[model samples]
Target: DARRTPPAETEALLTEEGLGAEFVPARLGGRLTRADLLARALRPVFRRDVALGFGHGIISLFAAGAVWAQGDARQRQEMAGLLLGGGRATILHHELAHANAILRHEFTARQSPDGYRVGGRKDVIINARRAGLQVVYARTEPARGPRSHSVLLLDPARQDTAHLRHLPRVETSGMRGALFSGLEFTDCPVPADALVGSPGDGVGLALRAFQVNRSLICGVVTAAAGTVLHSAVRAATEDRAGPVARRWHKPLAGVFADLLACDAMATVVLRALSLLPASAHVLAAAVKYVVPDLLRENLEELATVLGARGHDHASPEYGALDKLVRDLPVAGLGHAGSASCQAVLVPQLRGLAERSWFVEQEPPPQLFAPRAELPDLDYSLLGIAGGGDFMAASLVASADRTAALRGPGAHLGALAGAFATELRTLREQCRRIPPGAAALNDPAVVRLSDRYARVAGAAAVLGTWEGQDGTDPFLTDPAWAVLALTRTGQRLNIPVPQLPDGVQDTVLGELLRRHREGRSCDLDALAYTP
Candidate 1:
């Protein structure tokens, strides 16, 4: 009877429409062009129930995507048979401390002529016990650097599950359906082809999987919020209790607004996603960062509406509301979990901030330019022994002031127009510091370290492009990342002395204050202050 409680497996399978045309067709059934749809479906399921969604929902999406997006036809059919046949339920993640299902290993494979064995453990796997199919993400080489990972779908029957039997079962307050556990590979043997992709391509493909996971996490949150809104409406209309009627107005309004906003955002992202083959690291990062707030907001309002009813086990609202509270946090955290997602996002965004090229002019360029000339660029190399040293030092230069970029220059365009904003950011950041502390290498010093790296790279590159190159070069020059980093550094209270007070930097300064001290968001409420 307990097993009959319906994990939504049957229903979701019935709903598996494939990624349709959205996914890149690999061995996996179909592929998703954009990551947003994944989030859209996930939000509802998660809000409905976190544990089941993540535990089972995660595997389903991957199974589907693996077939559609990651799997070659052979892989897809193999997985399709098991999944469509009703036999797979194991998610092996967290064991490696990353959600990177495809990154490779620094350690090389160990083998005898007879066969080879994988000898590490997958730290935290979901639904790990007795799964017929195991989705194992492993490194071909130990310390294979970050990018050398891969995702492999395996038969537990082949590798050793002896370790699985001994893995400790974990207890969680929310999303308990996941049945979390760890794994150990003790002389585990597999055929030579266990590799997911060429070793180096592991991280890239894994990233694809993670993007799907993170985006869908938004759906989980939305669902949680929607459920709250649904319940509040029910209470306001049906419950006769004076308190329920009186207090429901504002909370209900908040939930309703949140739901609408969620839908709008979802639509925008989904449409945008369809146009791309897969979500980029930056786009995925943006979604992961913003959507969590939505989920948290939704759940908090749901809690408020339920109020006294929230605590009573006997109350109809108790189970779902309590579960919602537990589930919402998990979505924010993500599959490999929150902290892991953050580490990945922070760097990816930082890269986007640096590499992007833009100009804020009186009249923005035509609403749509041929997607060709993006951003800006400029660079020129000198006529040296081998080639010309780059001449432009103002807009571009080498890190140590060596190696001038040469011409027929690929990196030059109208992008230098941002010189005005870039200079302002540097000046402001410099102004914030007490004068003498502005070192170029110090991450804390705005313009000195990574902060300056963006602007400096911008200036250096743009300066090099003295004469003729197409307008296209400027569009893609990567000065945006520099400006963005400096600005954020300042806001975080981390000084980017090289660049300061830029609007985005200001936000970073604010964030730093929140991070170092108490977060300014109502300490009394979100903190659950007694």
Candidate 2:
């Protein structure tokens, strides 16, 4: 069962729903438009099954994103037509070990008079055997720099089968419902027009494409974590006198707050793709780096709350948690791992430390407003590095506003002030990291990047709470924000004061209310039918 694809009926249902159109842009004869909305639309599928979510069409989306981002008019139109017709597409990179950091491409594409001869093997590709379209990363030049690689769009159905071989499917511990396989190209020739972007723009195109994919992925995976938390809460309520149940109150509230925090960051980052493209890459990397770790920790805690039932795969009630626990790690390491994300932030921290942190203007409130209308996603605007630390600036701005509040909400001001101070401390540490040592190989730089990511996450929570338009009572309430920041502070090793009276009870009450009402634990609080 762990080595199989999603059930045939599930695949049929997804196809019937025209889910493949979600990958193609609206202008290109499909329904895809906003990045945040795309993630929201995919949540129901992910909430029920992460494997189904990916195995169905997200792999095609991932492969087609490059085409959408950099493909020529003909290429984009052709790719869009394929996706619109419910055909599958998959991406193939040289190796998974160096995700997004294309150090070298083992898959070679030698130049020919009429076309390029692609030859090499790409392993661990998702949906390799079934996809009709393939987007491959290849070394087009013999040199060893950023401009030596290229991406090629290929149609395997038209290729000569003699030179193209599909390797054996890979068996993995998680997301087994998704196919993972390899492709070996023996002098397979693709037309010269198959090139995406340009001859040496592979690295840039890949990075830009990843910025969108990474942000949306961070938002999508939260549904899985939300499901796990809901299950744990249900189990705890049924057996309140169990050993772990007695102490589940705080942890349950904490996980709920963490989920909200992750959603806040993810929403803002996804919106930034269209609203603030210059800084979106860094924000995306930060969310990608921090959210998974938080969700993984939340899952571990929920597992403990469920006790032995968490591992009981035969129990209809708790069996889903066991599968989710296995799938969350694979999701985290999918497009880019934690270290790769941190590596993105490390080199950019010094620039922000010197000129941006306190100096940059806070991002537009629209960046934090989940329902705000956004401009169309412009792939041309996404930069490799951020302009400044606008999210961090928002933290400082929120602290200033919180200081003006009086009465019970005054404690939140103090919490906000503490995070503002933490940002200042982080800026100094980042300033000290030598420019030459900002690479991932430097442990000190990596640690600094981690700290920066946490601070940025705290900033996102503050911005979201402030951006609420009094429409959602829970989101407008500062109690969850207080708990969210306190949890973040604890992670950063800051000595924080105890929560004010009734704060835990308030958050716990809302958590239970949502469960009893069959609502999701995320910020959306959408009703779910069981």
Candidate 3:
């Protein structure tokens, strides 16, 4: 339970496994060919420990994401080489500011006769002390406009040691194994070629990188939630004959459905990064905002099942559950906070409400198919503002298709119709909001954004169900999808119809089967030896 960096042996093992290559592109001589597969590869690490996942190399991947999005060919090759060689890298932001604002960075880099002279301090940086390469965000111009800031790729090995200093490590209540520190540069000179993109492209590059990283990180953290749920299920099964245990069964089934819904949304967003890059910006933001909320709520419900044992760090049976509960919040706050993600959606709502809501074409079925092959990810296609929201369009189309069903799946049509109505209401609300008022400062605007995110999540679930080809029996079953939609409708405060008699039993049975069979709680359903 001690808060410290990951043990040296664990770090060595991760390095030996070449985990860093997951962040590098295959074209650049690394293993990173797809974003969804990268998340799948990182699951074993997150499932074991959130701190180890962060401490080992996620921060390096976060740093490399920006370079992958905007860096030149030489920069990409250099970063790929660094990670492939087991060297660490990190991104230095000025502060934990809102994602939508034009940040006036305190970290500045002044132009000089031959190069730039950097002089500033950035705090709360992950891997700051251990990083050999730093992607520093700094103000290059005097103005406060978007063009004033630039991202500089710095090599501490080449810098003058006397001018650069690493600050003390910052301790946290969770994810304690992560190395959180700061850096200060006093007139450190660097070559002009260190820039990742053209002058003033830092903010744009950062936003695009956030689009990819937010989706990837959220997908990885789902494994941690699954781990906690497994613990709760084990505890509940101990008192199998008790009335309390029986009551917990239905709630446990509900939570499992929530986890599957989260996985569906995250999986679709990750695949969308490659297949539908134009629509990924808003979809990424929505997933980042919604998935954590669902996972956190699931964690809270599971905590009730564990009772006081959930808090006992000394109990070997439940100690990991307590640690995961503490670590879950930290994962939510990383990269972008919930408010920042909602802020990203606020301004785009009006545009989407006007042009894309019901007018756009439905996204291709492959956009939602988890097993389908995708186009190679092109970071160049990642836009700062989404051109359209095909996911929402797909929801409307799915509702129409579901309404035609005549048998056991009939209730899903009503649930899907409720969500479609929710979308139409969201459109009207967005249309009524005054231009430029859809900002973080307005509580109403934030609420609208939240509702929009939930609706988008519903769309993800429906699209996933519709795209399935009966390969996985669990995914193809309508019981889980019905419960998933019902739970979402509850969150939206809509009057959803009562679920069929045996839907809960079917879902509960699957949850128990997965636990007994050593399969993952999420949709991948990969078998394990535990």
* Candidate with the greatest lDDT versus the true structure: 3
Alpha-carbon runs more than 4 Å astray in model 1: 1-47, 63-70, 95-115, 160-168, 240-248, 331-338, 348-530
Model 2 earns a TM-score of 0.95
Residues 266-294 of candidate 2: C-alpha lDDT, one tens digit per residue: 98888888899877889888998898888
Off by over 4 Å in 3: 1-3, 95-106, 239-244, 332-336
Error of 2 at 264 (Å): 0.8
Question: RMSD, model 2, all Cα superposed?
Answer: 2.4
lDDT of every model, 2 decimals: 0.42, 0.82, 0.82
Find the 10 residues in a row with the least total lDDT in model 3: 95-104
TM-score of each: 0.58, 0.95, 0.95
Worst 10 residues of 2 by lDDT: 95-104
Error (Å) of candidate 1 at residue 367 is 14
In Å, residue 163's CA in model 1 sits off its true spot by 7.1
Candidate 3 per-residue lDDT, tens place, 1-530, comes to 47465778878998999998988888898888878888899988888788888767677877887788889998988899999998898877753321211132368899898889999886567777788789988889988777888989998889999998888987767787887777789999988999888889887877888888788878888887787777788888875664335778767999999988988889989999998887799999999999888877887788888888888877766766678767766665433478678778998998999999999999888887767889877777888885899888999999999999877779888889999999999999988777874366788878999999999999999998888888888788888989989998988899899989999888888988898787888888987644
* lDDT ranking, high to low: 3, 2, 1
The model with the greater TM-score, 1 or 2, is 2
Give the better candidate number (1 or 3) by TM-score: 3
